[model samples]
Target: MESLIDKDRIQVKFSAENQFAAIEMAAKPLWEQGYVDEGFLAAVMERERNFPTGLPTRVGVALPHTEAKYVIKEGISILTLDKPVLFAGMGNPKEKVLVEILFLLAIKNPAKQLGVLQTIITIIQNEMVLKKIKGAKDPKTIYNLINQFI
Candidate 1:
């Protein structure tokens, strides 16, 4: 499958005051590009409330996404923050995670969600690649690196 990642949607050196801001920033491009509907942001926020997506990985990440109804198409938005934003940990909502990377997704097909999650998790598990992404100098570099996965 062709990668849903778009270099134009990538954010580098981004800093958000909170998780909500991070998710908004990450989803904005997708929204503007018509990959997702207006309800997408609200859906993502609601979903996050019920099921956190933050992962305590090597470089702290959050994978925020909503249901297919909110998506007009499939795409992934990559946000690399300059400062870590607080997020509710995936498994333990009580635990707070300072996330530096946010993967905001718009998946029109529910079946692809699990596969996408697996792909992201696998990439994040590679410490070297994760480190490379964290230290990437530009959005292009990050986009190029992540494009390898999809």
Candidate 2:
């Protein structure tokens, strides 16, 4: 299987006004590269609104994703924000977290979703990795760092 973390799919110091914009920015590469279907973005945005994926880790990370039907090929789109954006907390939607990173997931294969999420969660839990990602000036650095965990 091809690696899900493509260097080109990673963006560093990405600027977005809000979480929705951040999700759009992060997911764009996947959609453009045919990793996801045309309606994927809409589905992801809708899912995000209903069941927020923002987690309160050492550094907040948002996992915006939808059902498998929207994915053409499984892939992960990564974005390290220029500024943290507000997203409803995963555990409690009433609370908000300032998300510094966005992991936009496109999973065509349902069985692999849990494994993928767990790997990304491992990355999110490591402050050193999050710091490295935050300080990264280029996508190659982020890609390699994330590839290691994957």
Candidate 3:
């Protein structure tokens, strides 16, 4: 997974005014690089709208993803915001979360999503890693930090 991800796929301190903008920013990398098809962004956004992906972790994060049928390859587009953005909470649609990080998941295999999300959940629970990621000075550093776990 480490070798598969390019540093450019990881962004740092990006300014996304809202969750949709943030979703677009994160999903762009995968489709632009041919990791997924053009419909991926729309699919992810639709899924997000119907069933939110926000999680109130140690450092808030949103995991926006769609069905495997929409994916051509596997990739995770990561974005860290300049300021926290609002997203409806995953557990409760009526609730909101201030998200600083977004992981746009493109998994070609449906079964893999669970395992990948488990790893993501682990990363979310680890405050030390999230803090390091939030404070990262460059995209390469963020890439390295995520590579350590996934």
Winning candidate number (TM-score): 2
User: What is the lDDT of every predicted structure here?
Assistant: 0.88, 0.89, 0.87
Q: Which portions of model 2 miss their true places by more than 4 Å?
A: none
Residue-pair clashes, model 1: 0
Q: Please give, for residues 1-150, the per-residue lDDT of candidate 3 as tens digits.
A: 554467868988999979999999998888788888888889999999999999998788999999888888788888999899999999799989999998888888767778888888888899999999988979988888878887
Instruction: Order the candidates by lDDT, highest first.
Output: 2, 1, 3
The segments of candidate 3 whose C-alpha lies over 4 angstroms from its true place after superposition are 1-4
> Any idea what lDDT model 1 has?
0.88
lDDT of each residue in 46-74, candidate 1, tens digit only: 99999998999879999999889888889
- Pick the winner on lDDT between candidates 2 and 3: 2
Which sequence of candidate numbers ranks them by TM-score, best first?
A: 2, 1, 3
TM-score of each: 0.95, 0.96, 0.95
Residue lDDT tens for model 2, 9-111 = 9888988999999999998899889999889999999999999999988788899999999888888899999899999999799989999989899987777
